[model samples]
Target: MSTQQTISKHLDKSVIWLFVIVFLISASVFAYRYKNYKTCEDVAFTVKAKEFRVGELIKFTDNTDQAANWEWDFGDSTDVKTNKEVLHIFNKEGEYKVRLLVNNICQDEKTVTIKEKLFIIDSTKLPVFNVKSSIVVGETLNVEDKTNNASTWEWRFGETTRVNSVEKRASYVYKTPGLKTISLVVNGDVKHTTTKQINVLPIEKKEERISEITGTNRRLGDGIKARPLGYEDKDKEKTKDEPSDKPKVVPFIGDSQFISKLELVSNNKLDANAFKEYFCGDINKNIIVNGKNTSFLIFCEKIKNKKLRIKDITIYREKGSNCINTVTISQNKILGIF
Candidate 1:
């Protein structure tokens, strides 16, 4: 071959070698990308929750690549949700297996624990007893439970009989009563325990009933008629000396009181008149916080510059005592209670 023809042949071989190298490099890169795509097709996600309390809303965010659809199984036997960012609520307290299905092809799962929320028992939310703080021994005491979100109840009558009941409404006749500590737990959760004190009077010390009519008098006819029934002679006395029939008013000073009032309102313990006493403005807004549509009462408990500026306040009407369910307040408010 001539020298020019040999050089041409060497150049063609060199070009062919360069093309083969480029093709190999391209194939390697394509393989790597395809492997990554397959790995990504199996959804990658993160489940974030600030709290895991029952009845709390949790948000799950999908961070998967090339994901076209998202499906979530909260493991509560509820409906499955399809969204890039899904919100879920667990009503019961337990460990829930949360599964995420991406594009109906790949799935990932996480276990979340739902714990019982710490609840501050309010007396106004509890059942009202027919008997007063003091009752006679062997007297039947009637109690009606009016608590909110309560599915079950356990009551300890605090007598020597060791009596207990699971009914929402119960009556107990105490055989012996002195200073008794009556306790109740709702929803079978010990976190909802409430206790109160009661006094039982002995039968021997019972007071005699007074006659409706007065004894005979010499000066006046029928002893001046003994005044009219339900008539109070003290009414003619000074107002300060006479007791008022109105309920004692308690001022809302800090966030603790505000939260207490909110609980009372939610549990149907507070009437409309009492509701207006703590809150100043209209509280009928349907606002949502933390993905819940229920009513929430939020406030700043700290007195900044000797004045408190009310923050987010939401209120809505529901059918039962669960109307006002959630409450969020300043940290100072909780500290102030102590």
Candidate 2:
């Protein structure tokens, strides 16, 4: 072969070698990228919570690529959960290492710091309030602010579920004869408020009776006789001396005395049933804390474990009956009492 022909053959061999090298490099790059993309498809999860406090429910959701099975370990010694989306609660507060295992192979973890729940209302922090206890129907009740910095006040007299009066000092009158609940919100802090109950009495009425002597005209019959004047007087004296059989009146517990008992009940359970007769024979009977009407049970719960300052209490009775139908209280109430 000639020198030029040999040189051309060598050039052709070099070009083929370069093309083969380029193909190999491209294939290697593609394979490396595919491997990394597969790795990115591994199992993953997320945790959601309203608050990191004990007794709060926490949510765990799986987000694994092509995941078929899921297992959750809350790390709080709870049951091993098996669900794509699961809820968990931790009884005790502490740092928990939550883990999610998918398909029994891939895993992810999160650390949750749980805290202790707190009493939402601090009654000790509330300001003192005052209102007149003797609230009568058709009479205006004046609610006075005893503390400083109170810019607004909203009062509800339990007649209706609406704010009847709003001012730094408010006045309201209850129309019906029932347990009346008075609510006071200061400075628009609706969450925390002062609640009072007062019994509005009906209009007073007086009852009177007149007695008179009567003369009787009698005719003497064959077998009838008239008693002697002295004998009749003696009979009257004996009848007066004999024991009377009239039923004695039942004792009544006045409203003022019941107010004393409630003032002492701060957080203690008192004998509210002592006045059951006044409340139609059931102390637990719903007497309005009067939530624009709060139940007696909820009112008791709100006063638990707190120092309560009672401003006043009123007892309202029916015009002719000794039974009390309404009672009101004024106090510095905790935030959640109502």
TM-score against truth, every candidate: 0.33, 0.41
The Cα local distance difference test for each model comes to 0.59, 0.65
Residue pairs with clashing backbones, model 2: 196-329, 197-328, 197-329, 198-328, 291-294
Taking every candidate in turn, the Cα RMSD to the unseen true structure, in Å, is: 15.5, 15.0
Most TM-score-accurate candidate: 2
Please identify model 1 stretches exceeding 4 Å from their true place: 1-38, 41-43, 117-120, 127-157, 164-338
Let me know the TM-score candidate 1 reaches against the reference structure: 0.33
Clashes per candidate (backbone, < 3 Å)? 0, 5
Writing each residue's lDDT as its tens digit, candidate 1 over 138-223 gives 88888877677777877766542232788889888777645555666676554234556677667887598876977555674544
Question: Would you give me the overall lDDT of model 2?
Answer: 0.65
